[model samples]
Target: MISADTTPPLTAVDKGRVTLLYHFVRLQMPAVKVSEPTFLTHLDRTFRIFIPKAPGPVSWAAYLEGLYAVDWLVCVGCLTGQNGAWEVLFNARTGRSDCLLVDALRARAVRLYPRDEERQDTAVTEFWGNLIAPDSAGTLPVLARYDGQRPLAPWLIRVFQNWHLSKLRQSGGTTALPDDEIALPMDTPRADGADRWHETFIAAAREWLGSLTDDERLLLGLRWRYRLSQREAAKLFDLNEGTLTRRTDKLRDRALEHIGGKLVAEGWAGDDLEGFVLTELGSLLTDDPRLSADHLGRLLAARGKSLPAG
Candidate 1:
């Protein structure tokens, strides 16, 4: 038995394993030169972090290899300096790994998050933005636990989906409603109250529109702002005319649904709420020459209303 004061020597197998890991990391990050002693220290620390969390005996190695293969080390290096994995490993001692890793993952998150054409009727651009915002530190920790068993993009998508679901559950689900189901009471506010209500309604409408994806915004701008025919707009976007028509109809319905929810929450339900949303949206569109009053008129007409003349 070894004395308590004496350290055990590394076995041949252990030494070989260290040599393999050193060469693997060096090959992956040729630009980052690290002394053997520094590398050995980082390797020990990395294993301590990785080993208990690994799924199998071989998983830790697989994860390290996969990270290198995907150039994640290079990305971390670029984020800190051009020094590659050495910078990352050095900074890891200072607890900067999460920040560097999250920064590296952000571009992939943006690319993988569900967007306009992917989902049937929701705009997720703002959802992605909110997930990556500085206030979302709770979400960033998930990156450290990524085992590299799957490609990073798909893994990140799954994480985002779960985060979105949790957010929705916490917020009591989505605020949007079906168009036909949105009926507001017809009571009109007095002249002085009308101005205040109109201002409030306009603010809500702007907020809802701002939440839409860029593609959704562009589609609205093309159809309403530019007054393009369905066929003309379809050709511009290289989409089939029927597809564009359906997409535009869904967009309008989504807008109505979002605005309707806000009104109901504010205790302003009934025909007055419907009227307020439509009238204010129309008025807002009228301010921009690019947005056609006739287009707003047509949308209002579908809901059994007409645009108020200037």
Candidate 2:
């Protein structure tokens, strides 16, 4: 129904499906009195924003799953992350997901008062407030620009750093460099390098996984480790496939960036980090004892949650 070739808004089948879904959603959310036409208009805008241009969905139900997730968020008024979507989706064990991003960027505030704990705390608070504060146009600030294309964490890292850098320059502080300034370091070869690299990557991966909420952890395990398709993931989460695609795109991207960034910080060459993630991450997700589907299944079963029936 959303293909490039088809110019009519939605096919008759999609329109009918949307009407039925709207009624189903409204039954639970009686307070929202959005008219059908208005709802269709909103869904059109949603498709344009999130779906962009994928070959139309293979199934109607699959495509609509994302819409349901997004709409439910809209109705409940929690769709936006005070830090944005990150707050809702990621449970970074270090703290809340939004706080995690702000803390990471707080270091880049360019004006650091290192010794005084009170000052440091205030600076962190200020940086966070500014990161998500609305602009003069009333649009959300920095974090709202995420488009789900790049690896989430790294993209965030670059975006936050660049923004901080820009803010610093405007304030007449130090000259902040852009992303190229954080150049990828070169790799050095060694016989035991692969083994050591795998060990380090796995350690970081497990720590990162432990930081997530159980649901987020399982979602990743299902998508990456178990190789669930977007449709299957939608069923498991009770979301639309289009919506899962958007969320999982960010989820997977953010996770890999964390894993890769740890390796790079430990002195693996930029090339090695990219190479290992591209070539080896799948195996690690699928075969590692920690991330294996069977292990996660047992964990879920222990929690009394069952996978959706096929």
Candidate 3:
């Protein structure tokens, strides 16, 4: 029997079993969630973001498990540190091993928690080395033990930095919508206010197009006329993506507001813009691919010309 003062020595077979469990646990860690307020509060403070913000109450048990995985990743990183001094152990049957879930935990940590450059470089170097090592057994056990001891500061920082970088690339240093090709929900019911807004949008588009100079016309054509995504349009016009996005949003908002006012001018007195007729206008804007100010002008002119005189 092992003495009370002495730690039990793990045999070679026991070590091998533990190593296998370590990998298994790392693989499974991502699925865990932490819902307890205390744990979540701690995670929020560490990561600087509220996680898994569900529309309603979340499954707390699952959330707690996720937090546990975070704790485990820190330990694993320490085990695999440059001066690792312990063999990571695992018991598959008992479910105590956490290394299997490291991937997802690492991913989340990097995404939610931005870290300093120096620490990130070191952790990344260690992670890659362990991943490609000739014999994983030696490294995996050591990594598992390290992560079990430390708080996952490096991993969280790396995750946040990567997420920020990705957003920058996707937006192309501009605040414009990522893509011009939007897929809106089809189920949204038309309201009177929406209808009025639509009609105003069409009328305003016509009027605005008439006011544009030749250069402005060409730029507008390159964007809305050619149906280019923001990035594509930005490249054509030599404009920044974020700037273009902001410009478009501002333009759209102003146009909508103007349209709402136009309804009042037309003696539509419901006070709400929703009751106005706008279905045709919205359809004209969204469904037709060959939208041009010239084409729209011609269409509206034809409609006005066909109307009967009172």
Task: Report, for every candidate in turn, its global Cα lDDT versus the true structure.
Answer: 0.49, 0.53, 0.40
Per-candidate RMSD vs. true structure? 22.0, 13.5, 24.3
TM-score of each predicted structure versus truth: 0.31, 0.35, 0.25
Model 1, residue 213: displacement in angstroms? Answer: 1.6
Weakest lDDT window of 10 consecutive positions for candidate 3: 86-95
Which residue pairs collide in model 2, if any? Answer: 65-240, 66-240, 66-243, 81-84
Query: What lDDT score goes with residue 15 in model 3?
Result: 50
Candidate order, TM-score descending: 2, 1, 3
Please give the distance, in angstroms, between residue 254's alpha carbon in candidate 2 and its true position after superposition: 24
Write candidate 2's Cα lDDT for 209-269 as tens digits: 6677766767777777556888987787778989888887777677779888888888887
Residue lDDT tens for model 3, 1-310? 3222222344576555444434544465533332244332333232222122322332222222223343454343333342221122111111112222233333333332345455445444454444324234444332322211112332333333343446546767322222111122112345757666555567765565455454344444445534557896565446799977776676555545566566667666664454333333443443232243333333434434211121
Model 1: per-residue Cα lDDT over 51-91, one tens digit each: 55433453333334323323333333333345555354333
lDDT ranking, high to low = 2, 1, 3
Off by over 4 Å in 3: 1-204, 213-225, 269-310
Q: How far is candidate 1 from the true structure (C-alpha RMSD, Å)?
A: 22.0
* Model 1, position 138: C-alpha lDDT score: 58
